[model samples]
Target chain A: MTSPAGRRKHGRPTISDVAALAGVSAGAVSKVFNGTGRISPPTAERVREAARKLNWTPNPAAIALRTSRAQAIGLVLTSSSPVPEVGAANVGLISGIESLLSPREYGLLLNVFLTGHHDESAFYRSLAERQRMDGVILTNSVVGDTRFDLMRDLGVPAVLVGTPWKPGVVDYIDADPPSAGIPETVDHLVGLGHRDVAFVSGPAGFVLPNIRREAFTARLAHHGLTPHSVSSVGYSPAAAAEETSRLLDVAAPPTAILYGTDTMAIAGMRTIQSRGLRVPEDVSVVGFEGLEVGEWVDPQLTTVQRFAFQRGRAAAAKLLGLLGETIEEDVPLEKPVLIVRQSTAPPRSR
Target chain B: MTSPAGRRKHGRPTISDVAALAGVSAGAVSKVFNGTGRISPPTAERVREAARKLNWTPNPAAIALRTSRAQAIGLVLTSSSPVPEVGAANVGLISGIESLLSPREYGLLLNVFLTGHHDESAFYRSLAERQRMDGVILTNSVVGDTRFDLMRDLGVPAVLVGTPWKPGVVDYIDADPPSAGIPETVDHLVGLGHRDVAFVSGPAGFVLPNIRREAFTARLAHHGLTPHSVSSVGYSPAAAAEETSRLLDVAAPPTAILYGTDTMAIAGMRTIQSRGLRVPEDVSVVGFEGLEVGEWVDPQLTTVQRFAFQRGRAAAAKLLGLLGETIEEDVPLEKPVLIVRQSTAPPRSR
Candidate 1:
């Protein structure tokens, strides 16, 4: 079989072209490269000479089909990234996945999820069943999803970038949970003599919003304090500011506030200042997610930082292992730490 | 010419399958679809009958070759977008491009520009020279670039997302500049009764940083005032805050500042407030690019906004035209406006 000329015009010569030049079958050329069957010395010499003359190497995709046993894997990204937190992290995740796939000769296909479409899961099924990708990594997965079930039915290996809910037979790497730092956070705020603390979280669908809400309330209960929580938070700075304004205007306003994400925390702090209240003075502020922008402001944001890049590496490592590769050393992520910045201080003695 | 069954195992039926089933050439089957050639009406009936049985259409890539005579296009992305601010814009651009390609049956490949790579242009040249793509869209093109020159030399169709530097021959659509409201911006700042105004621009390689610097200086000159411009800038929040800090501490600190991007303006505002200064009370601030986060802050952000999605649509429209599609109604972006929020108020009298 002779491969098309256009694909080989400026790229490495194809096995078919080498076979054609050597007066042999394409399978013979492939076998010579794979070293599977014993060939007459003269035929092997002819194939080798033709490959050398063309500076030819086997196509990575073709090799992946034969050896790696998979052609491609996909990373599905939805259009709506509510919190402005995932851009850099997504880059890190993709780069890490590439690090594994490049060496194994597998291709990565990016499948973007768009709204106003019929069904997002259908896209994944088509990719795996029709396009025949080995498996896929789904980002921004929701609370109840059909995509996971579809992958399961198709027997395609799947990995979720966020926590898998009620997933008995699925593999996943959850987003850094604020649950891990609630204790330190509560201790620090209480040590500063705060009794009434309010919490602002992202939208119900995102960041497993309840994870932070439950953790914050439980931790507050543990401290024998009143829990004032705000759920209906968007990824916008305006949402946080609006909630902060309402919280401060209450008859019994809290002495401190905790935001589910760094962007929200920073915006909340700005809103507090705009209302003429001092951070940590009138209302101490805390953030989840270790965003770099948290440090760019004055009174650096006292936030619980999540290592996105390292988490990405972890996801890629997990996916590679599922692909049947012997596991190498895994990337070490700094345990979620309470990054104390200038934003937190004792409330005014009351 | 029936397509192999394995190739049709999962995908929707393809033209090759019809040929295989009908025991005819793929070209003969295509002729049945186009209503061309001098095949007997009975043979044509057989081809049509086979197609109906399988339910297949011609692949657009194959059709594009015979009809549009155009090759595929790629969009190159850089991995420096760490914040949510840039993510939305990038998505807008990609989706706009997708709007055009989906109907034409061309695939969009994303080529990420990684750091630590010695030659950026070599990547594009190799893609084109090796016949990987017919052309590519270079986002964030730098000054004195070799990519444009290489494309010109190779006779490849190219589109740029940003302004093409020294681009004498390349086809490009420059980003929507805040041309309609610069005078209003200047007037508002000057009306605030402040003479000392500073401009912090983006990197020298981007947005032709000199364009903003020179425009800002000349605009000040136009208002019969001297200009203080920071020409060396990185697309980072820390860099903006540091510059804002140095400017605020100067012997004759400016009463107002202009930032090249919204992220910078937001960071600068935070830095100013961190120093125990009020936003509009201490200094007025302005930003270019209409980022949604601007509305989420206290006092809101007084900045200019860009129509990234619409501009992307325009870029796609231009490339589609190059791909042999007739240009229709062009995407019209609303004129750039200088938004005046509470961040800009009359400077406190010295």
Candidate 2:
């Protein structure tokens, strides 16, 4: 619609209309909405009433431009897998982060990249230079990750969601020790008389999987034993299945196998069953990351429960703190715990 | 870093620096990156080389402001469940959409909200008025949805990802007939000698589940039979389990049950087994939205394969088309198909 003067008609009212109705300058109306600038309490109330009547809300873009804050956070997921494998932990993390960010009216700028297919370095630089996000939450830290330095150089505040490869490299929130439940898993298997245990780790370069592998190795050494085998593969069902088949083909196959994630464990179980072996009775299986899908499988997955959702929330809160927002400091997340389920048991006496 | 002129020195060069190096105006450099304005091929190459030497990339925000295009798409997920149940389908959809958007240098602005906990209507309005997205992709269309009208009034282009409650109200990409594959499911069950079939549907207000329930009803009516029972519940494992337990308690319990999602079917199977009943043999089960998780569960679930990832990509392509981006027109998605697995069989004779 257009007015007689050829001005385009906005069916809904705008700030200028609100200001006119409230008998204040447009800037004064903006001050009320932005919660900045000096304005009398009564004048603010009048401006609010006018806004309510006109149904006018400040445009976020304009606010962003005025305040030099995008009012958004960035989350970039870089996976080498063909299919984007956003695990249940990642889902939980996203939900938890949204829980906090939603109330604050902050949007999440999510970018998914299949490692080699995209220029991740350029993406980060663009985000920082464009001022698209006030801060970013980084996940899946790798050994010698260059993102931390990149963010620092670009002057973008960031918080890492997993263990940093090097301590003090960045502000991070991690499951303390980064291998919290691995020792418990080892003790559980050893207590059940499992001497030959194997581990199927996530891709080799990831810090989390590396920590987990080392923990499994060190814990087994404590039992006066060593890993029967270790396979490093991408996080995918095919990878898990192939690794499981290879392990089963060994002369003295492992009595128990630990997987980097619950999804991997489920796939491994299917492989074992397809080979005509029973889980736990023939070969015990364990997983990391307590995903709900673990429970629906025939033999519920025995897993190391990391509070991914809470960690996501904590990471967001930490980022908000860095942005100078006052937040209630929550108790730091507890270490991951082992949840023993039907997938694991004493190995059969051969 | 600071220069002698009291100007902040960016360690990395800026567009102006690149322009200076190339002996061109900053606007010329912006034009080269944005691919606009007339410039000789050789000059463009020289500017690119200067940018390479300076390691400069155009800031997205500046480009956005100059062009009035945000270069992002908005996806709002509204759910009533306590936990954000971003099912495998949603995950697939996200991955599919990202597969296209990432290469175009576009970002996805994702927002998750628990229905009543957040004002969804206001959020949509904000997204439209703030120019935060070039367009939006809407999912989970409810009966008598107001979003369609709102988007229309706001003049924001949108593509609905699922069946529209009222056809022709919005541009949509959906399984043709919306009830595709239901007839096959009914035939598969009926041919397996299951006369008393019950259906468990997702939350009642959504268009997809309502269409599915109607399809089941119409198919059974053709067989001169009625549903043993029908239960409408939220799409959650707890809801599915509780409904399954209730269904089993009926005097004339269903010989076969159909579920709205793979996750729900998995939960239902667990419930049946918890009652000491074997799947297929005791009660046949079928699920929809053929998620990969179904394959890992014992007695792998039979399901209606909806091709969620393809649908997601289609939705994105359609949105891109609406945004005036030249995208390859993909063949329309085929009707959903039935995948027979171990979960379904002839019900045991009473």
Candidate 3:
């Protein structure tokens, strides 16, 4: 086989070269090629043989010009924070997308689109003009997201990875109900003999926080139980720790606390210990969103974890489906699983 | 300003339109475009106006066929495991590079290059031929790195983000000496009246592990103090925690232990408490990397931190320097700083 290094200063083998070797006109070769029409099978085979002898391959750029398909997809983290916890879903979403795209020779272009005044519409338009990405997965979608309408009007293919702000406009895949793990989390805590369980929720602007907060409250009420406190705070680790301490100071302190996220629960664990308290013995702690750190830390946390990898895979498959790829068999998305470890136990006997 | 919604269905203005507007032949218009050959001042102004009126921009694919600049940079995380700790530096590096590139309209393409079987050389060659990235940043550069020669011969600009396996082959930047944070950690421990200090290092395959290990041992020796133990192990949290427990079991237990990463230190802290020991009173723990969680935990960890954001910015600036961008004033990299918090104290009085 002719090697790229051995090739002369002459650029890629031209259609004329293939035509001359095959004893055919350039017009005949063009017909046999992917241009407009097809030539006789015998002439096409001869042209293919001549092309193979010269180690020539059709240029994908020229093909892209005719087809208008970039064969690439984009992923964006819709937050400005440099902190990793903010876009934790991106951790698995990336690998899942890579697993499928790399095999099919698709380029995955990723970037962060900071919320507010970033001109996301212009960015998508630029991508289309430059042939950067054919479709995108928008992470951290908020309620009443104008991006849905913007993408729709622009005629760009999109698959949102969060609960959709507007229904029927874009394809979306989130752990269904946005609170699939919360009811089970409450059940596990109540089963562990905890009555006064407080729910510390994340920021209110996003959907998951509200979903987890309401689910926790409603689930407890369903069991004829009352929460000691419900604190809503920003996505700061210190703020969560402070709120956990405040709950501890209340007259009716919760025997167990279920935090809206693993980030908050991990930080709260430290606050409980610093205040001369034990993990399961003094107050049980449960975290939503299973993080690997939860397993590594002391008294491994029992938390609710959405299968971020499977979610990413499902989202990517849906995008391929939009691109006219036939889905042979549907891969079922695994339900949210609760991981119980050393972080929870029966409430201490008075 | 015409809105995108109201724009005509006519495709991106063709070269024929621009040529007609300038009253010049298509061949002449191609010559005047991209400034390969200069045109007369009056003619150039007329062409520019015509192009502006037609809403025509230089097609990147056609330009790429002439000059081989893709105006894009590539980054790779060379690990197979989907662990957050593995790609920690990417969080800041993405933003730092984006801050500089977005205004210039450059694309940043990132993907993982798995180690062992994946051919890094073939990857670079394909990128050049496909116009994916004109340059790349190799994040997990290893000892005897061959990628330097591959990129150099392939004539692709590359910046290695770690200590060069062999110097002078590639432009590289790491926290100067890669041991910038080790000495201060020992100094703080000694100042707190801890005589017997132990060192727990990371996996030996990577440069940072060996760098931290040697620095920890050398610094302790410089104080005329012999270390209680110097253990080198894999990058597992459980292994590091187990090492800490073994160190505690010794007849002469270390008063303070310096861990290789914030990850290992967090796990070790739990082991101390699980064994019914106080943080500073029984055995003080200091982490190498100053992570945010370290600050949120019970006794905030006393550790040394490399400003990852500034390092990322510096690495990017160096890469741009390689790309022939004139950097007016030098941006000196910040040195590693030691942060003393509640994790360390004087040894308990016997």
lDDT of 2 by residue, B1-350 (tens): 12211221536677777777788898888876664457676787778777766656675545655776667788777767775545567887887787678767678888886778755665666566567677888998999999888888667888999989887889999987889989999999999999999999899888989988988999999999888877789888789999999999988889999998888998899999999999989999999998888787788899999888788788889888898887764635667899999999998888
Report the lDDT of model 3 for residue B192. Answer: 86
Q: Write the per-residue lDDT of candidate 1 for residues A1-350, one digit (tens) a residue.
A: 23534547767777778888898999998766543455675797788667656656564334433543334566676644421122434545666665555434344555555543424543443344233356778776556766778788756788887766565647887644536777778888988888888888877765456666777777777888767655567655668889888898888888888887787888888888878888867889998878666665546789987776666666667776787755565667566789998889888877
Supply the DockQ value of model 1. 0.10
Model 3 DockQ (Cα-based)? 0.15
TM-score of each: 0.68, 0.90, 0.74
Tell me the whole-model lDDT of each prediction, alpha carbons only.
0.66, 0.82, 0.71
* Model 1 chain B: worst 10 consecutive residues (lDDT sum): B79-88
State candidate 2's DockQ. Answer: 0.47
By TM-score, the candidates rank as: 2, 3, 1
What's the CA error at residue A23 for candidate 2, in Å? 8.2
What's the C-alpha lDDT at position B247 in model 2? 95
For each candidate, report its DockQ versus the true two-chain complex: 0.10, 0.47, 0.15
Expressed as tens digits, the lDDT of each residue in A3-87 for candidate 3 is 3223424677776777777888977765544423556657867876776567554564664455455556777766534332324
Better of 1 and 2 by lDDT: 2
> Which stretches of model 2 miss by more than 4 angstroms?
A1-16, A20-62, A329-332, B1-17, B20-28, B31-62, B329-332
